[model samples]
Structure formats: structure tokens, C-alpha cells
Target: MSRHDLQPKADQPHVVRATVGWDRPLQTFFAQVFFRTEDEPDEGEALIWLGTEPGEMLTPEAVIAVVAPHVEMPPDLAERLNAEMRQTTGMKDGRHQAAAKRSLFGSIH
Candidate 1:
């Protein structure tokens, strides 16, 4: 059967899809933060389902905070990530970037 044919019917709970990215070395960290399990696909990436309806997207800082307590990372990494994210997202400074990096990378070393 085709992939669609195998899916649950419309009456079933709707599934939301999201794409998350991380460095290859941080695969386990990402899985732990997002999935709560170490079992991850081999693609070195993750697709998560938050909910059916549109929900507030987690700020990068939020993501970092959620994941930070669970893993080990260097302090500089978090700082650098924050800087990059700030530049990319047009945030005023490293504040949000640091938060997002911490969320994705976990605790700094």
C-alpha cells in the first residue's frame, strides 16, 4: 500500500509536523531533549509533531532551556550559538541566541 493508505483515517487525532536540525555530533542530545529517548533515525535529523492546530513556536532560547538540563555542552558553544541566532533572527543581541543554543545543546561545560 502507498504511504498515505497506511496512515490513520481523518477521524483519528491529527498529527502536526516540525523539522528540527542539529549538528551530527549532537544527535543524541537532540533526541533526548525532543523525544525523551535515544532512539533516533539514521538521517541525523529529527521531525517532530507538536500538535494538530497551530501552536506557538518555541523560541530558540526556550528550546535551549528545555534541553540544557539534560545534556553537557561547552559554555562558549552556547554563547556562540546565541550570537549566530541573534544575527540571523534580528534579535538585539546574544540573549536569545544564548538561550536557543542552550536549549538545543543542553548545559555548557
Candidate 2:
């Protein structure tokens, strides 16, 4: 099973977007994460933005390490969001893998 297949279902708020790429100016990977919640879940905020590094898998550990300091989400809730992202996106569903490939390789695949 692909990593995307392990991602959690869309029952609650989850990471809707995750991207990582080269940052020429910074000479490092740039990672971005966007998690969606039902109607202003976080103090009237509908979406949460989190951290990154290019080429590295956007693991929950990484998210916690990077985003936790900036965001004030409960530990359990953050874990849930991380699980959702992993279960949904990390598990490669062929489609996501293709998209990931495109994102990383620029249509080379």
C-alpha cells in the first residue's frame, strides 16, 4: 500500500494541501501546509498554515516540530490532523503520486 493509502478519512478537519520545493534564495527547501477546518475552527480561522523542507516527506513529526510553535492547536488535535494528512495524502493513490512526481520532477514522469 502506498503512503497515501494510509491517510485518514475526511471526517474532520484535515490537511488539504502540502507542498515542498526548492528555494533558490534561501538555499533550502520550502514547505507549505494548509489544513482545513469546519467553519472557523481555530479562533475564526478556517485554514491553518504550517511548515516545510523540500524533498523530505512532510511527516507529522516535521509538522509538529515546525508548525506547533506558530500555531496554538492542542496536541491531540494536531496529532489528528497529522494522521489525516498521512492517511489521505501520504498513502499514494496513484493520482497523488503522479501529482507528487509532477511537483518534484516537472512532468518528467
Candidate 3:
């Protein structure tokens, strides 16, 4: 069976995790995100693990809502990031493979 075939049902929740290194840039970013949350008292240093169930259709806004506060990215940069992610994720769909292939080469299959 294909990987997608083994994946959980459309209604099921899929977990996506990102581990960001704690350096000068990341530290400043995290401070902004944690600044508002009162639940997290000790924000000096931590390995944050954000969890969400984004069903079948994954939206850019959903992702940004979680990450935007942490990092300061320009509108153009954010758009580029979202576009790149959409394209990368498109590879998983067999229907888009031909288009993806064409992206690598100048001509369509």
C-alpha cells in the first residue's frame, strides 16, 4: 500500500512537529510568542512543542497563526514560504507529479 493509503482517515488528526533551535534569532522570536501566554510562567528557556489537528485541508493561515508571533517575517517572505510549502506538499499528490517534473525541467511531460 502507498504511504497515503496507510495514513489515517481524512477526519483523523495528523500531528506536525517542528523543532526550532534556541539561538539569538529563535530566542527573540519565542519571547514574542510566549509574551502573551500567562499559563507559561517560566519562559526563560524551553523546548516548545505545539500540537494541532488540521484535518484534511491544511491552510497557510492555520500554520502562520502558530508561528507568526514567534518570528518576524516580511509579507513577501511569508508568501514565498507559504507558496514553497504548498508546492512541496503538492508532490504527495500523484496528479501534481507531472507539473512538479515540469518545474524541474522547462517542458511539460
Best by lDDT: 2
Superior candidate under TM-score, 1 versus 2: 2
Instruction: State TM-scores per candidate.
Output: 0.29, 0.33, 0.30
Model 2 spans with C-alpha error above 4 angstroms = 1-55, 89-109
Candidate 3 least-lDDT 10 residues = 23-32
**lDDT of each residue in 1-109, candidate 1, tens digit only:** 0000022223322312122222212211121222222354322222342211212322334344543443343455445444543444422324664576567656321
- For TM-score, candidate 2 versus 3, the one ahead is 2
| Stretches > 4 Å off in candidate 1 | 1-60, 89-109
Model 2 Cα displacement at 5 (Å)?
A: 23
lDDT, candidate 1, equals 0.32
- Candidate 3: lDDT of 98? 48
Deviation in Å, model 3, residue 50 alpha carbon: 4.3
Q: Over the stretch 1-109, how does candidate 2's per-residue lDDT look in tens digits?
A: 1111122224433644333333221123333545555763443341433332333434545545544433344446445545454444423336665676578657523
lDDT of 3 by residue, 21-83 (tens): 111111111111233234543432223333211132144354345544455434554364445
* Candidates, ranked, lDDT: 2, 3, 1
For model 1, state the Cα shift of residue 75 in Å: 0.9
Show where candidate 3 strays beyond 4 Å. 1-47, 50-57, 89-109
